[model samples]
Target chain A: MKNGAVLTVNDLRVYYDTPAGTVKAVDGVSFDLRPGERLGLVGESGSGKSTMALALMRMHKPPARIAGGEVLLDGVGDVMELDDEGLRRIRLDRLALVPQGAMNSLNPVMRVRDQLADGIRTHEPGDDRDALTARIRAQLARVGLDADVGGKFPHELSGGMKQRVAIAIGTSLSPSVIIADEPTSALDVVVQRQVMETLRSVQEEIGASVLIVGHDMGLMAQIADRMGVMYAGKLVELAPVHDLFTNPQHPYTRLLIESVPTLMAKRALASIPGAPPTLINVPPGCPFHPRCPSAFEPCDSEVPLPTSQNGRVVSCHLYPGEAA
Target chain B: MTAFLEMTNVSKVFSAGIIRRQHTVAVDDVTMTIDEQSPSILAVAGESGSGKTTLARLLLGVIPPSSGEVIYRGQSVDDLSREQRRTYLREIQPIFQDPFESYNPFYKVDHVLTVPAQKFQLAATKQETTRLIHEALDMVGLQPAETLGRFPHQLSGGQRQRVMVARAMLLRPRLIVADEPVSMVDASLRATILESIRRMKQELGISVVYITHDLTTAYQIADNILVMYKGSVVEAGSVEQVIRDPKHPYTQLLVSSIPQPDPSLPWGAEGEIAGDPESMEVAAVGCKFVDRCPVAFAPCAGQRPPLYHEHPSRAAACFRYDDAPTLEGENLDLVFERQLASQPASGSEEQAAN
Candidate 1:
């Protein structure tokens, strides 16, 4: 909604040093998360949406390395340049992650209260034990969980309950940016909406900018103000959710929007023709050219850079411009 | 004799924690039936502990019913003979939720299709076997060349799930039980898998028992739907009838909770997973959903409600349907309409929570 960038990735590249080949997982991906805005990174499986999220948080582990580009918070202090201590300091305060499969991430042996307290203690050691427990209970209550829930173990909690707990922990520090990777994919629709609502409420309470990664464009449209369409490790389109669905600029973006199953029994849920390309051996030019129906000569010969058009940053030969 | 498959007052009880006497009534007395000649999709939709999975297990004959019976054709599953059991295996097939776990990672994907054919004696010659495998794979939108020799890891989530469908097709089963088949697959890829399941009915004349918690997908694919809460079937009807105009409060809550792709229609606050776990244990009698149901009255706590027939094609277990006929539709509509009316265009109450 505003020009202030809570988090910005400038031509970020994360590659997997595999035995087969150097797999470009996040190939020159760039996007900005504005304050109080929810941005969704929508893509298919193996499309590197998750990889881009990990790179943003500097969680891209071994076998995968950040090859180039910068990750800046508020257009200052490159996240890539930070040391382990500085990275830890930057995390949970400025940048927080609600990890994938978050329900299973909690320690089953420990009580939910202890786990929440553990996270709070690691970040804010100045707070006393009682204050931390009170804060934990308060956070749990905010997500619709009972105060008694803090006393129980993770194993005792349901999938939805655990997910809410994860959100509570992720936003406990009131971080400026919250990156949730496939947060609601594991829960049912009833629980899914509940989790989404909880995430939204928590984000709103903290006024945090959220970046959610998911494969469902329709689900993303519900929470995200703007969505980035990632395909085979490249962001082909970035636009408002309504605009992305209605007036899609990129070919890959068009195909994805057309695939959603709306309530009205919208017909012709077209498949994307081919399987997602492997990062190990990506296509020569545009990684989506193999599946793109409107693929032309330039699509095969040269990779299209991010060109701004109609308030969207689209990377395609079709939308050729650099104006913002 | 008209009953192809019938579940009469079926129930399942499992012991909880370390106490043998402390039992959890997983699936309560639920009665449902599939007509003989009319083979169509019967979807069992529910939340996590709603017994949908339990019903699928009971249907597959993997677990015996603690009470009542599952009647197949004219015979009860508990009374099946040795020969009947063999025939039953071919008559009904199961498609599990996770694709990767369904098959052996060590074996080639083709083994799943070919082994069933060899065991069932569906094909004799090598050429015939090849043709059958190719056809089955092709039916699910996978090519034999690209998919056959590969391991489960080699394929995508959609591809692996389709292989499972192809394996089921090899048996040429009369019925298929797909339990949350697309829950693990990507959303866009769901259309392909669902289309494959739909094609089986038209091409092979096989009825599908689709068990899932996703209402949107159910609306898209299901012919009939049974919505369960805790362990009780709260609503059952034709897909359009139940989703479009729900009779039960639980169904209404479910229909309302669905994140409409349209940003303009914001969600209601009442049904954001606010149920108390202790509510299920408070009583042995009455509605399973009484605690969580927004419109629940005094009778909801005292006695269990019967499935009141709303439309000719639909039935719901809410006392409000017939008991409280005085509450006009317009009033209830106003109550629900107010939630939608109050909803902001884009941002939810979460925005206001700030």
Candidate 2:
């Protein structure tokens, strides 16, 4: 049972303090990532997948706080226990994040090389200008960018090129873990494919563990080794990419898979009835029970904890027992 | 014979910039028609800068085409009187990309439904307006109780989008130009919106000009799909024919790029680089796609290839066809593998350390 993954998150709970009530953005979520493995978290907009990723990085401020959880990176210790200096060092050296859009990440005014150099200079303060430039050029190459791209402003580059620069910036320090938040969602389909491909090769090249957050299951199928389904601020199911797509156990997961239309086939899309429940005052019992098809008496009363089944896990009453 | 809706050699150019002005050719010389006999869905699909958005505006008569004429009912759109223009605008409704923008944040959700019903005279009195609103909500499968009186902020994106579709439906427009209507909605709820659009065409007998960048959704509802790239349409045919076997290299890339939810098919890194689609000079003589095309030979850089009819229902614009324009240079083999296409642009990638 001990896979010895580099990062293990257990009982992670992130809640926002709203005037109305506490919004449980990420409640009772747990997952582990092997050192060079890719993990994908897919959910609808308000499913709290992005909040969970932000929580993983301990980026919660006053409004949003990690109420209870333990984020244990193999050598970095519990992220919750980290103080100001620890958080800073760990964030810069141990973890890197590629935010929602690459366009948002880069400083439009600064040269691409300078921006990357800024990343290295913060961590490796002793490195000279030439050394930083060399490192920046090297990182650019790692993300399949040209050396000349160093001098150009962010506006001069295409969206895909800007995205590559974002990747390079994220991976510049050779961080152990990289969290990509919907890297390709804003792009054209063709460009989206190309950006995803770059991320894949870069993941392979650097051998860094990746935790990607996006709503596109089709994209996850291509990018991740394992996939997790998040709904109503809960991690509903976790399985290998192929297994999750082929044999989704949870009713919500099953319906979620059916809802997405794939290019390979044009089977009828069964739209999941109703929108996602609000995290602030989620429905009692199962958050998904209101929209769940196989809602029995139990599903409407008691919350289902994630139960392991067939080398994977799902949080639903359907799979109540342990794996056979 | 006059077609029901005709766009004859339509082209739109914009000259912008202050110090250094640059002309942008958003739509090239494109001719298309939707027949009156068959009320089928015409999907104009392409990536950004493909001019699908401009074409939608032109169709809606929001902007006049720089050269071409848009004819409706055997009359030029330009020649239509002010009264006729209003009627034309009502008949050819448009569904914008963002649903939230369609409705004002200040107004109640049902207010959008009321204005259209009242303006178009679908209802006589207050009671009749409410009835029409309820009926419109029913058509799009929205509960009137839950949707009515709620502000735009309260309604979910899918619900807001549905309300927009319902609003457009109440008018009973002959043709609806839905430009990326489902793009903002969640994936789980996308089918419902697409289904609603399909039902409008099939059950209501309204034609649709569905403009989108997503091809799978296009395939699901579109009767005819038009593939556009860099301000020009490269391929046009039935969904089954064009998607099954794409003739143009750009169409092939767009088709192959669709991320089908299958783990077996790996995301290949090497693909065509869609280089600055916006920066391509407006006056360039050669094929616009030659820059990113995988099978670009000598002749492709000289002249634009005419649209070659591959079948009665399908056509493609490429030099690979047998009816290619004669050139001084020899015509090479028309073969382009996606993997090889990515190579031409990447020029010796720098090696990464372990």
Candidate 3:
């Protein structure tokens, strides 16, 4: 909470109990989200960025367990230590999650109005019907949706509209922190731009810190103030948006940035040579060392601890001596 | 020389619902051609429900176009002989979007390769078939030993898609219609897969119709670009011309909306998502993009604009180029400025109200 950090995650570890062994989905990832900051988590599929988001929300299922971590919210205490009832009370009030798939998250049977009202009543049950209805309309308007949209089911709306409804529900209570997971991945380019604009406007109005998780580096670069690069469940590098793109410290981050196809220039994409490592049997030292171009002697044998300086964190043998 | 493949005025209509039939024009009056002599990558870029997939289906001969001619090697695909049909099927291959769903999970990955080999009679003996499979796999950068005998689920998404490319390459097809081939694969692996496709065009002398919703990928590998909107081609030109200086309003929106991977280039003013195209029934008379187009005019609602040739190589389906009568072209900016000045704002508002 000090230095105006809205959320602080320290040494977070989320493990999935598979039949083979313990798969480290999220391994020792740590970062602080400042108030009103838009932080992006960029990684490929199975890189554990989504797992980190779920673990932060304490929404991980039975097979997936949070091994150890401290998700400390500013006003609310450590979320990892909260019980079922305590967690429920603070869920929509302090922290909110806008899930990956809008169709899956929104209740198909319930009208959009009732769904919004239901979330409101769960947190603050004293509001009468008229007040609740007004609140629902306001929430709908906040996400640039017409009030009549509340009358329609999830099936009736378009993909972008459904995503907006999801955003409306997540921010109905004006939570301190909003976690959007691939919010516009399924939408068209035009619609995706509109949706991201809506999200940015809403976040600015509420002044809430946002943690967006997705694989699209272009999208992250456009929206996020700072970005964290994850490889094989590890947070390899965290820096401001410009620094991350201009001078990527981690080899994986550099390759990822280069690999992203751009409209500016038609150059041969720098594809990483090897396949993404499997979580169940990750390589012995740094997970990215095998695929890294600049990997050296200490990389394959020793796990590089995270080192922090000037608001940037990097975990690699390339940058040694300054340990966290 | 005759073009390898050409679709002239292609249109496919599908009627859904039982009691009251609702017709959807999936592909509307589309015309494209690829030369047999010049191997190139032609990108058909569009959003969902834009009919790019329907166009791919038409090219693959999975479903016949309701109207228009699909000519393969200067012969009507519909009028091909039995032997010609077999040749057509083998020559033009399709690589679909989802690699996981493309294969049957119960069968090992080798089945996809062997079955195609046997059906096409690419190899005579069992040993010959094995060698072909191994050779195809090697061409895609997949180690034959590691990739073969594994189930589709066991191989990574990138690997499975590569296997699909290798299968298509097995027949040495003249043209490959790859529909969103890299969309489902992971980001890191996309470059490898696209590289393989590009390699096919360069090395094997195979043309490709690369269909995708992502323009960045299209701009990366495609030689020419066709931007589609609601089953209609809004713009068609070389990748550099279309992407750098988009003519049509829709193409401009698409180019501007792409989230560039640079902090220096931020998104502009907020854009509003218009009415859902699926729910709003489009009339058969006018332009399909008039509802969402920013620079739509009074003429757009009255009649569909033909593809006006702005330059020798570039064309756009918009009224702004209608005044440029000659192929040499006029100052199109003057025409655009004049059109915008004369347009009434209430014209679009009235159309929306209707």
For model 3, the TM-score of its B chain against the native B chain is 0.88
- What's the CA error at residue A309 for candidate 3, in Å? 1.9
Which candidate's TM-score is highest? Answer: 3
- Chain B, per-candidate TM-score: 0.88, 0.87, 0.88
For candidate 2, write residues B285-352 as lDDT tens digits.
Answer: 88888877777898888998776665656677888874743221210111100112123212221011
Which is superior by DockQ, 2 or 3? 3
lDDT of each: 0.80, 0.82, 0.86
User: Which structure is stronger by TM-score: 1 or 3?
Assistant: 3
Sort the candidates on DockQ, descending order. 3, 2, 1
Query: Candidate 3, residue A65: CA error in Å?
Result: 0.6
Per-candidate DockQ values are 0.39, 0.58, 0.69
Chain A TM-score across all models, in listed order:
0.96, 0.96, 0.98
TM-score of each: 0.91, 0.93, 0.94
Candidate 3 lDDT tens digits, A1-324: 767799999999999998889999999998999999999999999999998998898998879998998999998889999999989998988899998879789999999999999889999999998999899999999998999999999999999899999999999889999999999888888788878888989999999899999999989999999999999999999999999999998899999998999988889877999989999989988989899989898888899999887778999988884786
Clashing pairs in 1: none
User: How much lDDT does candidate 1 score?
Assistant: 0.80
TM-score rank, highest first?
3, 2, 1
